[model samples]
Target: MPQLKGIKILLVDDEPNILRFLEIGLQNEGFEVLTAQDGLSAITLVKQFQPHIVILDVMMPGMDGFEICRMLKKTENLAVIMLTAKEEVEDRVKGLNLGADDYMVKPFSFDELLARIHARIRNHFPNMWGEVVAGPFRIDDRRKEISYEDKVLELSPTEYELLKFMAINNGLVLSKAMILDKVWGYDFNGEENIVEVYIRSLREKLNDREHRLIRTLRGSGYRIDVQ
Candidate 1:
């Protein structure tokens, strides 16, 4: 079986070589992928392919990376991971501040990227029907309560929603928009930053338990797969 199976990944970049390299790497890890060469194409693929995650490069011609991400978040159901060629701290902070689940600078190890992806997956999908039990991490969706070693976990409403959805999806890649639609409901009028804020809340609650689940797929959406 594929190591990271059952997730549809959308890879966007203006460069053919970069697209090919990322595609091969993701495919080798057992992912189903689609590619787009520019901003317009990326938007089309995001809507049509409905990838679980997006691997977006920030330097594409015409639209550019920030604009694409802004567009995706504006749509109200897209989850995005950004890729940068530079290690500018502002860029990284900006991506996270904009509701991007994760961002990585180029020349980084593929393994590091994979690890982040896997962590996002597991964090986002830990159970089914809003519940899962792995030792002390007992999460019950019906009550929206998580407990470690039988101790009750105090989680915010947004955090609860994140955990609930992740548990239900198990090993599926859930785009940011998908998460927003399901968790915040279709009527939520808040900005996309809401998603990132909730994710951080959830992460803080989970603490060191964070791992390969609920991972980010750069330029794509989020996933709930175990490494």
Candidate 2:
């Protein structure tokens, strides 16, 4: 089987043993892994590693995993998974609503994690390049490419994924709260800074003055519509 290489992961938990085990497991699967013990540290690591995926524990001192998941979703370019102990409909709902690509209960199989990760990766960037055109911006899903007025825009992998998510769900009044839940990961609790940061970063790259395809709906999240 051809290997899936270069997937960077950030594992956040207060338990050192769990962190070590997960890191080893992910590394064994050929993924680069980073770990954090708390929410603040997780955020910093998130900024530094800019991980492709995050496995966050929902319970922690100071800032819990849910809180962290909430923050990361709002970030410019990040994806997350809830590796938590909460196993209830409400917990699942909470995590999914936060932007978690996937969620798993504790003692989950490493194989399961690997599988979910692979699936999401493939889903986000397929081989078909299913094109999504909104105004001047065109998204080629297969190659994970986006362009404005035929000018190719440089986008980070996370940025491309975020844009694609919004483009697919265009016209819906997605909340900043929900975008954080759906696009980022479920482990996030309630921070909104990450989402805003990424939006700003995306605007800078998209040159909002010219394109401004991403719109900020008052009292709502954001939207992309052709004017």
lDDT score, candidate 1, position 15: 81
lDDT of 2: 0.76
lDDT digits (tens) for residues 1-227 of candidate 1: 11544667888888898889889999987778999988998888887887777878888779988888888887845457799897889888887777788887886787777666655655654332244553345667578787755778688777776775665455567777888898888998889767767766666666635645556676566665532
Question: Top model by lDDT, which number?
Answer: 2
> Which 10 consecutive residues of model 1 have the lowest summed lDDT?
126-135
> What are the lDDT figures for the candidates, one per model?
0.72, 0.76
> Which runs in model 2 stand beyond 4 Å of their true positions?
125-227
Per-model TM-score versus the true fold: 0.54, 0.54
